[model samples]
Target chain A: MLNFDSQGLMPAVIVDDETGTVLLVAFMNQEAYQLTRESGQTHFFSRSRNRIWHKGEQSGNVQDVRDMFVNCEENSLLIRVKQHGDAACHEGYQSCYYRRLLPDESYEIVAERIFDPEDVYGTE
Target chain B: MLNFDSQGLMPAVIVDDETGTVLLVAFMNQEAYQLTRESGQTHFFSRSRNRIWHKGEQSGNVQDVRDMFVNCEENSLLIRVKQHGDAACHEGYQSCYYRRLLPDESYEIVAERIFDPEDVYGTE
Candidate 1:
């Protein structure tokens, strides 16, 4: 069995299968892990929402799992997937990692927005 | 400022700069984050040890940071680095994620071992 932290969650790193681009990092509870394995789609445990998150449930940006790997410690997971939508980040970037940290500790926008968040999410 | 979790730690995904291979996923406390930023090397907070960890401190497998990116949520970080040694995993694989999950829920060794853990860690 895979190890879960004290919180019963394990961090999962999602990557683009072909491009090797890191898409998102999220946590997965046992239920989420089992669901992903059964459905071949990425599901995560949202820490804030305290529920199982079906990726793209809100944005239609679901990730189709291509492959999965478990770290040696069994405390984390690496998932390669085919991202269904142009954006994986809720902020509209292709990747969640869109801000490059500079030498001076400032951040620069390094990725172009693939979609307009306002158009998709309809303004919080 | 980057958002740390309630435990004052943030997850960081380390990647190979040239290959874009996901090398490791670790955590960083504020001190470890500052040390990594100052030294241009990967420093992590060892949850097991409850202290700041300098990657390669004992194994001599240091990762030289090439670039860093903060996720849109400002909670996680992606670090691209030049890996110094043949392996990043204590178990002697280039990556910690060396075991691929088979469809039947079994694991397969997908990556070749780069070193012997017993030789390096003196058989813990």
Candidate 2:
């Protein structure tokens, strides 16, 4: 059995199938996990919203699963996928990990923003 | 500032600097984070052990940080490192993610075990 923690969630690391670049890290509840398996799309438990989130439901940046793996402890997952859109991050970057952390404890943008967030999500 | 969860922990994804292969996912509290920065080695907060764990302290498989990244939301981190020794998993695999999940929901070993856990950790 997959080991969900006390909060009934396990971390899922999403990776780019072709590039092997990690796209995002999200959490999955059992329901979200089953949904992802059944649908072959990414699903995550939204901690802030307290609901199941179908990734790319709003942005059309769906991730098509190529493969999934569980860690030795079975407490975490790694999913390699074909990202369907120009970007994965809500901030319009190809991956959420766009900033590099420097030794000085500061960060610098290391990736080119792929799209305009204002055009995709629109201003609220 | 990096966002730690309600429990004061943030997930850190470790990646192979040379291959971009994801090695492991672990949790880091602020102290562990600072220690990692200072020492250039991975440190994690062990949930079960209730303390900071210096990765490879006992096994001698320490991961030396090459670079680090932060996600857009600042809730997670990615660390690229030069992994010392042959393996990263306590289970004796190059990566903890050695099992690929099949469509039938069963998993298969996708990686070679580089060492024997019994030899490293001993029967405890």
Best by lDDT: 2
State residue B119's C-alpha deviation in candidate 2, in Å.
1.3
lDDT of 2 at A9: 95
Residue pair clashes in candidate 1: none
Model 1: reference contacts kept, as a fraction? 0.87
How good is the docking of model 1, as DockQ? 0.90
lDDT of 1 by residue, B80-99 (tens): 99998868899999999999
Regions of candidate 2 where Cα sits further than 4 Å from its true position: none
TM-score of chain B of 1: 0.97
lDDT for each residue of candidate 2 in B31-75, tens digit (9 for 90 to 100) = 999999999999999998999999999999999999999999899
- TM-score (0 to 1) of chain B for each candidate: 0.97, 0.97
lDDT score for candidate 2 against the true structure: 0.94
TM-score per prediction, in order, is 0.98, 0.98
